[model samples]
Target: MAYVDGFVIPVKVGDRQAFIDHARQMDAIMIEEGALRIVECWADDVPEGKQTDFHRSVDRQEGETVCFSWIEWPDKATRDAAFARMGQNEVMMKTPMPFDGKRMIFGGFEPIVLLEKANG
Candidate 1:
């Protein structure tokens, strides 16, 4: 089964383009380090909930937006190796993230279910 690393990030609403640019750079590094695919999504219709929500989960501020992202790997071992390699990557070390890294939430997951449409 494939492995996945998921993330919920809090980004400044005004830095949308900067965030994309940063993701583009960092995502390429992830790919080079062995990630199979990278998907980054900006908030569109996120709603405020009384108890909890995506925004509350990440402690999003008034001027920030929630971003959902994921990285796919062939397997857990590959993902682990890639992460180790990324830790020493020069570009990754030099590039600065546009969002507040401290507020970002991330975790590795083994998918329980996955579905895709036929290519037809």
Candidate 2:
């Protein structure tokens, strides 16, 4: 089964390009470190909810946009090992995040099922 690490971050609207640039660098590093793939999604149609929502979960403020991202790994063991390695990498440790780290939400997931459409 594939292991995944997902993230939701609130980034200033004006910093969108900067965030993308940052992600590109980070993605390259993760790929080099054994991540199968890196995906980054900018919220396009995220809706506000009365109870709880992506915006509320991240305590999003005006002039900010929500970003959804994930890293896919071959397995849990691989993911764990890569994370440990990343912690020790100087570039990974020193790179500045474009968004507020305190407000970001992230977790590792064990996928129960994954389906993909066949390509013709």
Candidate 3:
């Protein structure tokens, strides 16, 4: 089964381009470190909730947009090893994040089921 690392971040509206540039750099590093693929999504229709929501979960402030992202790995072992390497990685250490790191939420998930459409 494939292993995945997922993230949700709140970025200021004015910083969108900066965030994309940052993500590009980070994605390259992750790919070099063994990530199979990286996917990033900018929220289009994220709705506010009365009780709990994506916005509320990240304590999103006014004029901020949510970014949903994920990195895919072949398996848990590779994912673990890559992350371990990232800890001491010089580029990662020096690269500044475009968004608030404290407010970002992230987790690792083992896919229980993934359905795909047949390609012609």
Candidate 4:
């Protein structure tokens, strides 16, 4: 089964382009490291939902939405290897990223059940 790396982050209102620039720079690095696909990315506006809602669990506010992204790999081992490589990259090593890294959350996500993959 393919492995997926998921990321979720809150961006202050009106900073979408800055994040995109960062992603563009990181895309090549991620691909070389083992990402088969740099999947979906989203910059959204808040909708009606509970403060503790699963999607918004880590977010708390009315104005702040999320920047979400996913990277696909062949399997977990490949993903792990990519991460290890990323750890050594100078770009990744630099702390206090140009973009806000704290509000930016990321992880290697294992799909428990992909009920319906098709979406229009």
| lDDT of every predicted structure (CA atoms) | 0.94, 0.93, 0.92, 0.69
In candidate 1, what are the lDDT values of residues 9-70, reduced to their tens digit? 99999999999999999999888888899999999999999999999989999899999999
lDDT for position 79 in model 4: 88
Q: Write the per-residue lDDT of candidate 3 for residues 1-120, one digit (tens) a residue.
A: 499999999999999999999999989989998899999999999998899899988999989999999999999999999889999998888989888999999999999999999999
Model 4 gets an lDDT of 0.69
What is the TM-score (0 to 1) of candidate 4?
0.74
Off by over 4 Å in 1: none
Give the winner by lDDT: 1 or 3.
1
**Candidate 1 vs 2: which has more TM-score:** 2
Ranked by TM-score, the better of candidates 1 and 3 is 3
Question: Which pairs clash in model 3?
Answer: none
Candidate 2 C-alpha lDDT tens digits along 1-120: 489999999999999999999999989988888899899999999999999999999999999999999999999899899899999988889999999989999999999989999999
Q: What is the lDDT of candidate 1?
A: 0.94
lDDT, residue 46, candidate 4: 43
Q: lDDT tens string, model 4, 1-120?
A: 478888777665465676667777788788888788885465555464654542464453455556677898889999888888898989867733434565566887787766667888
User: Ten-residue segment with the worst summed lDDT in candidate 3?
Assistant: 48-57
Compared with the true structure, the alpha-carbon lDDT of candidate 2 equals 0.93
TM-score of each candidate?
A: 0.95, 0.96, 0.96, 0.74
What's the TM for model 1?
0.95
